[model samples]
Target: MDAEVGGTSAEEDYKPESWYKVKKGGKAVPMQREERQPEVSGAATQERPNHFKRAAGKKLAEKSVGKQHVRIPDGATRIILRPQGGLAPLTRLGAARLLYYVCKETGIFYGDARRDILSPNEALQTLLIATEDKKRAEKYQQIASITTEEGSKTEIKAHMTIPESRGKGVIHNVHLSVSDAEL
Candidate 1:
């Protein structure tokens, strides 16, 4: 192996010179130098990192609540919803009502009931899904009203009030065991 010395270039040494002869098996062998293309002039030799650009600048400042635009400052504020009872005791009708109201006011639709009482972070997962369905999301705002009206017409409260009546308590029972699909 050979290397460039001092100011000599890589090409100057890659080609065989008169002083040194290439040989194989104690016999002189013809060496074929591969042709190489010249680098482009003024071409950017330094690799640049890939950068992402958003053309819709400053438009991100405009906040959207469902389909409506809401103006707020660039600070964080927490809105608390205190359950009528402790979280554990929160029934499906109660949780759906609270969730409906929260979605109405905050423009965040978390869908319906959860088998487990979710923390704030887990609740945010529903928001990601909400982003896709803007119109249907508004339905969540009125879910409590629809549910209440339907329940009143069907005497749902009286039926659900019965203790340990599993199948009979449709709304309340489903609320306790509902999945992401219902949401």
Candidate 2:
């Protein structure tokens, strides 16, 4: 038992160590040197505080009074709507109606709505839709009146610019005729 224990101890002690021999006549040197990365300091080393930690002690001001009412500006008559991209005429008209109602209820101007309006994009689109609807309705009404008269023939001639998406160029001359029989 003593011999077996001595042999095991000797085996454990004989574990390999990496060493390099010096070229000029001398001793074995350790092949590996102990190395540590340089510690980073100052602003570069500091981590940014998380949002919750930064705002931990801050308290929002409480409202002392009820919310202030928005007032419409003086001398403002109509809201302007500018539609970008290719939107349908009906869509522009619908947007206009929605905006008209919103302005009426909120008592806010077009510029003010950017901040106060729940959805600014929807409001703008509503205004455009309303404008298109009005223009188209007026033109159709004029045509209807001419076609309604009894026992008479009428010709309506008009010129209008067609939208770019429809095709090239403005419609130069448009002519329509209606007789009592057709009506």
Candidate 3:
């Protein structure tokens, strides 16, 4: 706590003057009550009362490591695809081909689905694989969307920055569980 008396410094304000002096002998004896200054604003204030989370939240705000948490709406069923590991970013033409490859590999009808694999955050952000059927989308989520580079056998699977773990961090039945993947 701070007692601001018309713009006084902290050190001057922290120490309170003696209220009165009592005379005991020929020479006057001054009686003063001393008080310990409380930690008002600084690291010590948080450490004393366990305001640890504030410091953690401040640190988190300072260093934003990656993209904001990607959340898809729940009105539709969709599977999110993101390039995994050190795989090179797919060009627009390559993205289109990969979308087709994923649909073909997953046994989904190309007509019933819609994809946006070459969006603004193509390399980091997730591209969605959506269909009218919820079960098919869920099934596709289970299967890893993989593709090989043009010449070499560089097998890449579609994964994402954040794992699809929700509800107590337990892996539940896909049919009954909820995830951040639905679009």
Candidate 4:
């Protein structure tokens, strides 16, 4: 068997023992052994742009820089509206409820209110923008004045009370006359 394996009996060729003895279909055949080459051993190669770094770059701290100072007009009363006492649902929901109330009080359309209520931050932003005109919508301070009820799920009950504008071309009387002491 050894003589036949080495090709001395006219079956195989003489070669080093390191050669492979591949068995196929119940028959042993001599085949050259494959030499293993050195592999690229280290971190896996990156195929895409610095995606990991880019993702981390987006996580950097955000900074806001600005100064806001308002000079109150003489004889103009300052009204400080307090946040209703209640079990505030997350800040987002509070914002939504606030927005819904503002739009309703301001006589905004239901569809517009719905859209604003969907995004509280945006609604609050809009409300802030709408209140910028002091002469039109002066802040009022009266116990009977509109306010939110206190409870776990507090809701808004404020009304938009704008001052009267004395001008002839003013075809619409959309202003309310609250006591100056309240303003």
Which numbered prediction scores highest in TM-score against the true structure?
3
Local accuracy of candidate 3 as per-residue lDDT tens digits, 55-106? 7887898666444534554444555555454334444436566666666667
Worst 10 residues of 3 by lDDT: 152-161
Judge candidate 1 against the unseen true structure and give its global Cα lDDT, from 0 to 1.
0.34
Residue range with the least summed lDDT across 10 consecutive positions in model 2: 144-153
Tens digits of lDDT, candidate 2, 92-175? 335344444444333435444433222223333322111233333233223311111132322322223233344565443444
Candidate 4, position 161, lDDT:
28
| Between candidates 3 and 4, the lDDT winner | 3
Write down the lDDT that model 4 would get.
0.39
For residue 86, model 4's alpha carbon misses the true position, in angstroms, by: 8.3
| lDDT of each residue in 96-150, candidate 1, tens digit only | 5544544544455455322113222222222111222334333332332222333
Badly placed stretches (over 4 Å) of model 1 are 1-74, 89-98, 104-183
Pick by lDDT: which candidate is best?
A: 3
Model 3 misplaced stretches (Cα beyond 4 Å): 1-74, 92-95, 114-120, 123-125, 148-183
Tens-digit lDDT track of model 4 for 1-183: 335535557434646665556586777666766687545544433523377776666655221112222443433333333334322342444655555444444555545434221222222321222333343233222212223344333333234423334233543544467554553
Model 2 scores what on Cα lDDT?
Answer: 0.35
The alpha-carbon RMSD values of the candidates against the true structure, listed in the order shown, are 18.4, 21.4, 14.9, 22.2
lDDT agreement with native, every candidate: 0.34, 0.35, 0.53, 0.39
Error of 3 at 13 (Å): 52
Give each model a TM-score: 0.17, 0.15, 0.36, 0.28
